[model samples]
Target: MEFFKGDKIYNFMGKRLPFLGFSTILVVTSIVLLLTKGVNFGIDFAGGTLVQVKYEKAAPIDKIRDILNKTKEYKNSSITKFGSDDEIIIRVTTSTNSVSSDLSDEIRNVLKGTGNFEIRRVDIVGPKVGGELREKGLMAFVLSLIVIMIYVSFRFEWRFALASILALVHDVTIALGAVSLFGIEVNLDILAAVLTLLGYSLNDTIIVFDRIREGVQTSKESDLSKVVNESVSRTLSRTTLTSLTTFFVVATLYFFGGEIINGFAFTLLVGIIVGTYSSIFIAASFLVQLKFSIEDFRTKEVEKIKKQKEKEKMRAMFEQGTV
Candidate 1:
């Protein structure tokens, strides 16, 4: 099934400079934001206490805050509405990662005055444990990038592989920048979202690169710009549809999935759009900058591709009754 009919070609590579410039600005801005504002790391990595509670009626957030303020330990804690108004989540930064019965008792007792409520659960993490988790999370992310370099380099030559990786970095940095910009809570789930988008972005890029390779092998065109433009146009319909459909689903999750998954959804939301853009513009532009030509292959493959291009041209000539 062909999404694009006819021989029309779009100048995708021709306008790459603007998109690349825009992407560069966004990436630099995101980095600055991360260095300045930073991300809001959840208790999962910051080392803290989480106290979840449920009330038969809507939770009185203000009244509960006032009541908890009376105590010293939880006075500086944070409270947020959970799934419903009746449920609430309380976070308290702790010096130690250890769970103390006294702390739970204190939190439960302090909120009890707000009205009849049930303590759903309590989670505690100390400073050292939080630091370790934070380190590991960062390590995991970096290691994934390393693996991508290895995997993609194996799939294509170094030039294409490098382009793919740079495009991914662009998507990830901006997504993280958005998180920091919006103060999204960084947690295990959010990290998972970041990693998930890596594969997705790479998949989109590989598709375009694959198309370019086929075009090079068969098209009787020496002009790289035209070949790239044709390849991208052929795949534009699929990329647009896939990204649009996925965006709608993720947008639903961001709007309706509640605060619990908002960060995760937002990461994916930015990822899909940026990923699509980078794959088409950033990745392809980098390939063009690398001076990709028939030289990437050896004598045999180059000669073979030349022969294939000749056959294709002859076939077209025969159809036109010109030879």
Candidate 2:
């Protein structure tokens, strides 16, 4: 059950700086790619046609693809088995100018010989809807970041809030860069994965921040860097264990969740690893450069209580004066 023992706890703090520097470089490079090339948005954001067809018997993807490829109408078609092997969802790229009778005729002909399958369903996503979803996704992501910053700032310090946000950005950038470099399609499913990663990465960062805050409260005279190191060490096992469990689940989904969920699972798989790294190396290291001290914690809490008591005393004095 135990992954690591007590002695190894203090070992990582020694080489933390160089590891952090390397992570920073990787994250920065990823950001550059994201800003320029951007993500390959899928049908959910780009708007396309979704068609479902069910066969009398289980059908193979290649066979269905070959039939569709015969017609120039489906040159850009994506063929995959649906929930049941007998069902298939064929996605053909469609535009306002690209819609044609020939494509529909060809699809019907292909399914005629295969089975008693009919057009199970048809949904057309317009450009306007896609554009709106794109805007909404961006807004949701930005708002989540703002909320996280405010919460972290109130709970710990401004420096920690900033560090946590930076780490979230780092995780997102690297995940986006991965999609770009590897040519992964960014669909609605993958967008969900990205949001999930944001939350998961933030959770990891908060765990360390929480530990750092506790250390600051309990050890009044310890060095901030040493306290951060201790905090990181204390939570190392938990982070590793949680990440490993997530990795196993995502890996299973990637291997067995079928083509539809493959991209989503892959995105999550990469995000989990990158998020873990940023939470530890990138986020924790930021504390070293920050002007952090245990006294700040004590002063803020003491000052707030003092101010409250002073306001109460002033109210009492005002009441007596009025009398």
Candidate 3:
């Protein structure tokens, strides 16, 4: 089913500047926030201990925090309810070089007075390991962009690749900024979500780029901007459907997936919205600004025709000589 009529045309290029300017402002604000406020790194990135416990009965989160607060050592611990009211996860960062076993024992003892609870698991990360993980996570993100740029450049053109990279960066920065601005903890799971968004955003972009490439090859329109605008309009229905369907799925996860997957789902939700916007506005707008001309395609077609004519003339000459 088509959301838009078959012959409908929207002047996306006409409003290119506004779209681009809005994206630019978003990206710049995100960068400024990232530089100044920074992300709230979770236990995985910041050296810490994570303890998951399940109580026999429903436990009030505030009481748990109160129990931990009795001990000065555990006063600053972060407590979050997991899948249910009986389940909770607590994280604490300590400068003390206590072993995981010791830390686990300390945590258990501190909460022993609260209620009968079972320790599901405990994880510990040292400062050295956390620093390594932080570095690698960043490297992974940067490398994904580099790889995407190379692949798009090979599949389409350098201009297309650059534009796509910028869009992907835009999607990621805005997603991360939203996370930070709202004080969502950044962890390995969130990092994975960001990487997934890179691919998701690129897929949408490639679809639009493919249509633009086809339009340039087939359309007789001399105005490259018109060709781009037409190309985006043609794919509007498909882009909207894909984004909406994906958003529904991610929104479900965000609401129902529990605390473990909350960040992941939220990241996907933000990425999908931003990614869809960039494909239509940021990517196509860049093509127009870059002066992507249909002349390049036409010139190549003309050369192919000239070569074919030369071969045909040579064949005729040979046939005449034989005669």
Q: Top TM-score: which candidate number?
A: 3
- Segments in model 2 whose C-alpha atoms lie over 4 Å from true places: 6-13, 35-37, 52-90, 95-106, 110-123, 305-323
lDDT of candidate 3 over 1-323, digit per residue (tens): 78998697888989999999999999999899899999999878998878899999986679889887777767778898777889998887864554345766776777877889988888878778889999999999988999999999988878888888888888999999989888788989999999999999999999999999988888888897888888998999999999999999999999988887898998899999999999988888987787766788689778989999999999998999953
lDDT (Cα atoms) of all candidates against the true structure: 0.85, 0.80, 0.87
Evaluate model 3: give its lDDT. Answer: 0.87
- Per-residue lDDT over 293-322 for candidate 2, one digit per residue giving the tens place of the 0 to 100 score: 677678897899999999999999899995
Q: What is the lDDT of candidate 1?
A: 0.85
Task: Give candidate 2's error at residue 37 in angstroms.
Answer: 4.8
Of the candidates shown, which would achieve the greatest lDDT relative to the real structure? 3
RMSD from true fold, candidate 3? 3.7
**Worst 10-residue lDDT window, candidate 3:** 95-104
Q: Looking at model 2, report the run of 10 residues with the lowest lDDT sum.
A: 4-13
Comparing candidate 1 with candidate 2, which one achieves the higher lDDT? 1
Where does model 1 exceed 4 Å of error?
Answer: 1-6, 95-99, 102-105, 296-300, 303-323
* Better candidate number, 2 or 3, judged by lDDT: 3
